[model samples]
Target: MEFDLSWILLGLPLAFVLGWLASRFDLRQLRAENRQAPKAYFKGLNFLLNEQQDKAIDAFIEAVQNDPDTSELHFALGNLFRRRGEYNRAVRVHEHLLSRGDLGPADRDRAQHALALDFLKAGLLDRAEEALKPLEGTAFESEARLALLAIYERSRDWPQAAAITRKMQASGQGDFSARQAHYLCEQATAASAQGDEATAHTRLTEAMAAAPQAPRPRIELARQQHRQGQPGAAVDTLATLAAQAPGALPLATPLLIEAAAAAGRSAEALALLGRHYEQMPSLDLLEGLVALDRASGDATRPGRNRYVEHLAKEPSLVAATQWLATEQLEHEQFHPQIQRALDQAARPLMRYRCAACGFEARQHFWQCPGCQTWDSYPARRVEEL
Candidate 1:
């Protein structure tokens, strides 16, 4: 019934030997796992470099399986899936990272951003918006705000777009004053459509105050004034615009002529247009001058003569076509066919073009419908460019 001291001494050494063996086995296993993970990672990288996305994804999945705690591997896998248009897989991977309680603040934000990108790429706008809103004060704030701005613009949510632009302005991201003006103009258009003329005018006024240098609000305001039987007000607005943004005179010329004719100030409008045309000879300005001269009963100089005069400044096909219409031709019967061909050739040259994306349109745009860029289209026409 006595404890054996011999047994205790024997067991102590035996236990130490067994513990050493187990520790050695664990060390070997850990080394093997470490080597395997890196091997898989490098294999994935090689596949990625070779542009074999499918193979790279397989390798990355193997690496992630080999090292579940490797956040970088998970990120790579998620991004690969996202790029491969595997939104469900990308969302799941990012969501899994977010679910981990051991993740640091920065990694958590990254996971959230990745999740938002997945939703955005998948066209799940509502989900993307929900995911992105949480990244407001994070490092991804600017990118998130821009993405949100695009979403609002695409959806035509003017109020939300305006709010986002204001936030971007306050953060010193960029000057969104012009964009803010566009949003107000959009709101004004909506108000005008609803027969709320007072509200429309107020919004347009706010828009003009927001970006005094912007042309859209003033142009829109003038159009509204003309519609409301305020021709003098419209002419005054366009005259101010011509002074402020002389380059935009081409776009405003047609409106100015109409307003001036309505207000009985055709002579003053013609002088203003001529002054700008002298500085920058725009086809639109030349056309405006011709229209005004013809309307004023000035037979001393024909409108066709203005096209001939414009030809002296620039070799415009449009101008030549116009001049050919009234010129004395030896074969007057063939003039119709020749003029038709010239008109067809000059029509495309008369289109307004986007400076950003090269999207040509018959009319000028404040924003590019193709690239979703604001003020991408120049004030001048394609031929002028």
Candidate 2:
């Protein structure tokens, strides 16, 4: 039987030609698509540089559509959407990247992080937390933990914040002792307010153990003790604080004096305050000493002499005002008005100021309200600073 040799020979060339044409067509299409993708991407970049964000986003979306497998394009598109405040679109872009089976581990993490950021920016805290939770084992672990900490803090979930901080501390990220102390102090405050004195005491004690150098715990514990009619214990606690955290003595001084007077330990309190004044020479310490002296009916020096001595050392307006307030002026008629004005001016100088953000407050804060920085406020007053 004739096997159609002629047809086979003819068909072979035809098949080869068909294959070649098909291959050429495919290559052309691929090159055209590749060129189109870059063209769109570059157009987007140009628009972005020109501050035409709307146009840039359109171009990026086009590029992403043309090059669906391009991770960089997806990232660019996601960021663009986020920058445009289109969190939903940003989330979609990042989520799509995360869903891809061929994504690298690092890229997967990046996508997850982007998704979290989108949710956070959109004020979707719950979704953001969920997105950030899986980032624990990735390079984004520290960043995710920090974000999670912020979330918990904003929600006033102290327990969760403490857990994250402890985890971060254990991982050697940085010291979170002070933050932990603050969380415990917050809990203590709440417990004390609820009439749970024992729980408050326990929490404050734990806070002190967590960060001995932190002043809030000791101060709070002493206040609690004073409230519970344990003024002697409160004075003892404050003395311990003055010894352990001397830089915080100014803040503890008034409380210490109150506790000492209530506990009939004015003599001991005066001695401790005098010692602190000798070492630190703070106006608050001097005030504490004077108050204690008056309460004990002991005149170590004239009540105004301490301010004079402080003025000689520091040239402080606050000190000068204190001295003048107690002095018999030649023009005594105007003294009251003058003292009131001087005191008003000095009040602001006595307030604490945050070093990081220049936020001024009457009380010293571990965190700056303006910038949310921890340990931003110096121990010294605005004038001292």
Candidate 3:
């Protein structure tokens, strides 16, 4: 049992040598793995900066595989997939991130938001709504609510849209009173279509109270009153609209003139319209005045004279054509053809144009069909603008 000390000392050095070699090997392997991960990540970033998305995606996938537990890499890859319109892949990536037990609260919320965006981009409204609901009180709450509002609007769910607008208003996310009024107006329109005058009236009244400065509510309310055999009330509502939002009077000029005729208040309507035209010389206002003048049997300030007056103020092809239509030309044989050509040229100038997107329409729209922007079209026509 008496062993030699030489054997013990010899075994110790050999074991130490093996341990050092193994440590060096492990260090080299770790360094190589770290290098590969960074190399792939930087390569992906370079590809992205160069606008080579496909190559960037391949590099990102390689980077993610090399470092599977990296949350940032997962986010980048998920966002890239979403940008590429690969919603299914984006959803999977974000869902996998959400499923990870080690992920932090913020990261989980981000993943949830990303998943919601993927659903929204894929035109899955129901799924997007479901995914976005849990993000309340988080940093992504505002964005989620806006997306939800847009979805509700797209689906014509005015009540939901109004509720979201209220919440956004309470949170100091800018004034949404205008939008709230629009929603109520939309709801009122639907009610009126279904022959529910009481509900429509209530909604329109609420809309006016919600945003008195908003022109759409008053205009809609006036229309409702006029349709319900209350022309006097309609005139009063429109008069209030003109006083409150003078810029919007042109949009309701025809209705105003009709209501004035129905209510037998042509003199007051003429005065109000003339004052407005004096302040703002819109073609619509001029047309309203001319219609009332022609109907009044007053030869002094004739309807055609107003066109001549408008021409003196500003050169308008529309005004010139209207004035010429009543003139006794020396060469009257081709008058019809000349009138037709002039009318055709003047028609486009009478169309309204959207301020936000430059979309033109023969009739004004509260919301632009082209850009989906509310109150984009001004009351003035393309010529006036």
Candidate 4:
């Protein structure tokens, strides 16, 4: 063993030389691959900037093939495919990323999100839901839940929409109380249509509790009570509506007057009507007041005179038409022709217009039928706005 010391020293130097050569060989191979990857990547970037997406995709695919473990390049390719409406290709690229065992948690979540988006854009909602569900506890949770909420809404799955909204509210995404109230209202309406009065009542009550300041639930509940032969209850509900959400009273003027008359609450009704008219004069409210006054037959002021008074406050063609129609003209021969022409001109002015998209309808909507926006319509008519 002592005689082999010189041989051991010589063998150590030879082994070190071989090791160095092997390291250099591996580094050269890695550098060559890295150089090819960047060149392909830059080519892809150039094509992308030039708006040559198809060529960019080809270059990106080449780059990804050269650098197979590059999560970023795979993401870029997947997103580019989606932007080009090549959803199948995007899904494939993302699916590949998800299948890789070496992919980090963040990249895996990103691929899952991309896959869901692909399915959503392609109208494969069922697939999208499956893809998005696993991302619930990830950083993509909020966005995933929002997408799921939209899916449920589009499918008219009110229960699912409510569940998602509750979760989002719990997460402090924003106050979803109003939207949850709307969901309950929708469920109530559906229950009412199906002759499930008890369920409808419960749902409407929940909606009211969910959004105490929301006017629709109270209004709807009053209608339900009136239909169920509970005029007293209906009147009481409307009284609460008048006190709590007075800004919405004009829109419900006719219903309130009817309910009040049914319950024999004329004095209370008159007081509420007068207060609303004084604050914000609406043509509908004025008409309701005239009807209530006429019904009471305790008319201190003429019912038609309210129209004239409204005209004094605002140069309303609608009010002028109403006043003139209620009067007998001395020139009776031309009165019919004048009335017909005025009515024709005022017809369009009575329609409700969406403030968001400028779409007009003959009736007011809580949600804009044109733009699908909630509470976009003002309580006032087109002429008032």
| lDDT tens digits, residue span 215-288, model 1 | 98999999999999999999999988988878887898899999999999999999999899999999899999
Q: What is the lDDT of candidate 2?
A: 0.89
Best by lDDT: 3
Q: Which lDDT tens digits does candidate 3 get at residues 41-148?
A: 999999999999999999999999999999999999999999999999999999999999999999999999999999999999999999999999999999999999
- Of 2 and 3, the candidate ahead on TM-score is 3
lDDT of 4 by residue, 166-265 (tens): 9999989999888888899999999999999999999999999999999989999999999998888988898899889887888888888888888889
lDDT of each model, Cα atoms only? 0.94, 0.89, 0.94, 0.91
- Candidate 2's C-alpha runs over 4 A off are 1-21, 49-52, 296-300, 328-337
Name the lDDT of candidate 4. 0.91
- The window of 10 residues in a row where model 4 has the poorest summed lDDT is 366-375
Q: Looking at candidate 3, what is the lDDT of residue 47? A: 99
lDDT of candidate 2 over 1-385, digit per residue (tens): 8687999989999999999999999999999998999999999999999999999999998998898899999999899899889998998889899999999999999999999999998999999999999999899999999999989988889999999999999999999999999999989989988999999999999999999899889999999899999999999999889889988888888888888889989888888888877887887787777676566565656677778778788978888887888899899999999999999999999998888779999987767888878778877888776
Error of 1 at 336 (Å): 2.2
Deviating ranges (above 4 Å) for candidate 3: none
Q: Count the backbone clashes (under 3 Å) in each candidate.
A: 0, 0, 0, 0
Model 3 has how many clashing residue pairs? 0
